[model samples]
Target: MDSIQQFLPIIAMFAVVYLFMIAPQMKKAKNEKKFAAELKRGDKVILKSGLHGKVAELYDKDNSCIIETMSGKLKYDRSAISMELSKSLNKPEAKS
Candidate 1:
């Protein structure tokens, strides 16, 4: 009973950490992976570094892709794509 009481706080701390930090991170990674897998040629996306371009080619085996930008086409890892920015860019503008 005494040992369980001593470990209670540690267990609670771990639960809090998992709920507040680890869980959201895992969810985000899963969503990002889904986003990456769904990416197809001609879909517009923004990189983590903020470079915007349309996907030119996807190398699924290597998890990399080539994007066509105004300057030229460039290659980047699939993980470099930003979900939030890409979604926002693809959203239809609202009229007031």
Candidate 2:
């Protein structure tokens, strides 16, 4: 009983950390993966490096894509795209 009591705080701390930090990170990663898999040609996106462009080509075999920017088309891994930023960029603004 005494040993369990001593370890209770540590266990609770770990639980709190998982709930507040680890869980959200895992969820975000899952959402990002789903976003990458759902990507298709002609969709606008923002890269992790801050470049904005439209998806010109999808290479499923390599998990990569070609983006068409104003300058030219560039190839990059799908994971290089930022799901949050891309979604925000594509979101329509309010009329008000």
Candidate 3:
């Protein structure tokens, strides 16, 4: 009746927002997860901590990666790796 009519617009707006905004974000996150799980050694990557390095080692069972930083090899969780870099982490290091 009247209550349903009044609430319909609000529900419609929520659905619209989820479809246009939230759903895409979730989909992108899922794809990112798939990418992260497939990471391997020597794959240049960008971490959530902003650490861009080549994956020197990957422990699949423990879910950790050894990143080659300027200082030395650094370890980080697989979840902390945000994305795979397009080029070698070393190539850019020697330039600067």
- Candidate 1: deviation at residue 3, Å? 2.8
Point out where model 2 deviates above 4 Å.
none
Per-candidate local distance difference test: 0.96, 0.97, 0.80
Better of 1 and 2 by TM-score: 2
At residue 68, candidate 3 shows an lDDT of 96
The worst-scoring run of ten residues by lDDT in candidate 1 lies at 84-93
Candidate 3 residue-wise lDDT, 1-96, digit = tens: 999999999999999999999999999889877877788778877887787778899888888889998789998888887654433443456565
Rate residue 41 of model 1 by lDDT.
93
For model 2, residues 1-96, the per-residue Cα lDDT tens digits are 999999999999999999999999999999999999999889999999999999999999999999999999999999999999999988999897
Better of 1 and 3 by TM-score: 1
User: Candidate 3: which pairs clash?
Assistant: none
State in Å the error of residue 41, model 1. 1.3
Candidate 1 per-residue lDDT over residues 7-88, each given as its tens digit: 9999999999999999999999999999999999989999999999999999978999999999999999999999999999
TM-score ranking, high to low: 2, 1, 3
Ranking by lDDT: 2, 1, 3
Candidate 2: RMSD to truth: 0.9
